[model samples]
Target: MTRLFTVPLAGAFALLLAAAGCGGSSTHDSTGDASVTIRIPDPGNEGLLALGKKDGSLAKALAVVHAKVAWTGSSGPFAPAAQELGADKLDVAQGSITSAIAALAQHPGFKLFAQIAPNKTGEGILVRKGSPIASVRDLAGRKVAVNKGGTAEYLLLKALASAGVPAGRVTRVYLNPAQTAPVFNSGQVDAWAVWSTYSIPEIASTGARFVATGGQIGSQNYSVWAVRNGFADAHPAVVQAFSRYLHDAGVRQAQNPASYVNVFTDAGPQAVSGTARRLTIQDLAQTAAPDGIRPSNVTDFDAVARFFAEQKITPTAVNVRPYVLSLTGSGS
Candidate 1:
């Protein structure tokens, strides 16, 4: 049982727990609630977060620290979540290291605490069946779809560089995850660069084929989690507890992806089934040594930061070292 108490005069209380549905950015704020609600971002339709939320595992995990979660789900891109974090609307959210680095370059309101590891599969370039393009090397002078500044764009750029194909030669069609499907399915773009959530489903349904994966492109990008600076300062234990829970769950999900079928946040239970589900399970199981949440990798963070800056995506390269914090110790 959670011991409820009341403070007649708490110094500062900014309660911002929002139902804020997915597919659009919506926020709700209040300061009257006695308990603190840690706001988190997700895609809403599918993810481990949604699964845990649906099955009550997440709530149970947070109850140990006397914290609850206010979920914000959106479907467009990962960059907007940074604005939400800066606005004090989100306490923690997940995105590639590049996204975090770019956000830190401009806002400096969030810090990278932990990361999900072995992000080698599910994100890469996909081409429609019977297409003339054979590989990344063949993408020269082709129209490729990518989410600007998102991991997909980064991967496509890296892959093109690896294949000795100039990005200028390949026209990049910038599209969010939502808009690219129709255009790609209709062959408006020669290929689509995307993450697992879209790539897996797209391939399963439309027979889209991956020309190269992030791993194949030698990408060091990671699925990283970040927390608002003030929120981490005030509630380190909650963040730590949540990280521990995720570490355990990540291990489980990697080992037995089928067990977490109910964690679908979008399609209820049946959203992920058949080949897509199989691919999802196979993708996780393929990670022989899953690196669950651990201390921040400063080198990797700095590298990604510089990569973004060099690509003209950010104003300048952020060291990203100061933003790296140790989960087990005082904020680093």
Candidate 2:
């Protein structure tokens, strides 16, 4: 599987590509007429890149010359993208570095390209305000809600163990963040492990308090980028171009905070409206950059991988070096 990281910087290039649509073949021209579509996760939090796209930064540079930009987000698209490279389905897939690893474990077609910005914040444990549960220790013997088949669940498992609670001591009740909230408030679940964007605001509205955050666990747990290996090898130039632009976008997000949030607010859903999403995004953007956005080369990934292995989330730990595509051949 391919994994990469990015930051927002410019526009105009993206705008020109957006105008070209998806009918043409993936041919390159001096004026940049090639078409490339990328899938992103949580498009709502993807403000900086979306802004670059809307402003035509990537399109103008790639469009009509050798590249076109189509932004798609879907979990099911990974396998299809791998099988249909010539059909022009996808060039890049956006997701957490771990998710990319999992994808590779399932389908070893994608390759790691480059590093995107570290999704530094946006996680927290929630409990209704004035509830007797004030900290992670209190979760003992009480039921805790989590999305069963999610990274958040792993995060919570680790966080709880690190917080001095036995993993088996706390009951893990599977539930989506949305479902867990009401049940938590109603006493169906004692506490809920959730991302900050939804959980923080929901807690504030319901007078809840936070018990922990993902950031407390480490940096490699956030989002990253990936591309199909065959596609990256066939089109090195395009991969490099996209990687540079994404890196620049990460720089822009770091340099300007609120502006990035505004970009997402314009196109994102109501759930992230006003201050909640902005705060959450700002929080998540601080986790620190990954070496090409994959865990195979990082220490944090080791801890995370061990946690997953112990949890039996995967049959074995992943070796990220052979899978990742790095400019230097050595990781950051």
Candidate 3:
């Protein structure tokens, strides 16, 4: 039996109430009426699910396999979505590679199947204008805002380690992406480690400067899509169809980003401006290997797992390969 865990409804499942009637389960429906419940972050620009919903492409593609998509809104970090998946409340979701690894370490049924290309434009450590923190080395003993176990935390760790700063010296302020901007802008935090979604808008509004970027610190942050293993096994055809749909939609966005005006528009002016500044047509392109899990991905995941273990974020080292789903034969 799958162990069901409870998460704070107000925190993680705040947006989920809107889709209350859309039920989810681990067992695939054998009656030929198959459906998938996917958790998409509000204003999610990284995946095709949101864009496809607007353009009707997702519906058209899933129709080929006689499957349907039930879209649910997600907020904050990927932990909530991962928890929902583990509890059999979600069929598919996307999140940062670090968060996915952390989730897989805790949960047993999740599988990473596809990946989004890494973009270096927006991920970095930001300090307020005229702040004395001029470099990664300056972060020692400073209060830094980062979403715990998310990409921001991972990048901060890598940056600090690379700069020879003792991880224990920095005081980390864990906040959701929504809460990060307010704390950072109000000077409550010395620095904010964030990605494009929060960093771009903050910089544009507050003139915050980048102390160091993921690229500068040699951190590669890739976003990945994952699904429940039982669902994929029981409905391979549906999984393949959804993966192909995402790939095709990603290609379209890469070739013509302007085609996704609705997506940018829905994300708000700040997000719109951020998207324009941080993303390029090429950055949205699907460059993932056919198998989805590349050697570099494995190595990076292992490194993150080891880091988490060293930091006592995880109880033990986790091997990530067994949970990776190879879509090479999916015919996408």
Query: Highest TM-score: which candidate?
Result: 1
lDDT ranking from best candidate downward: 1, 3, 2
- C-alpha local distance difference test of each model: 0.69, 0.57, 0.67
How close to the true structure is residue 66 of candidate 2, measured as C-alpha lDDT? 64
Q: Pick the winner on TM-score between candidates 1 and 3.
A: 1
TM-score computed on alpha carbons, candidate 3: 0.80
Indicate whether candidate 2 or candidate 3 has the larger TM-score: 3
- Tens digits of per-residue lDDT for model 3, 123-199: 88989998999899999989999888778888888889889998899999998888778788788999988887677
What TM-score should be assigned to candidate 2?
Answer: 0.72
- Evaluate residue 73 in candidate 3 and report its C-alpha lDDT on the 0 to 100 scale: 66
Q: Arrange candidates by TM-score, highest first: which order?
A: 1, 3, 2
Residue 46 of model 2, lDDT score: 43
What's the number of clashes in each of the models?
3, 58, 0
Better of 1 and 2 by TM-score: 1
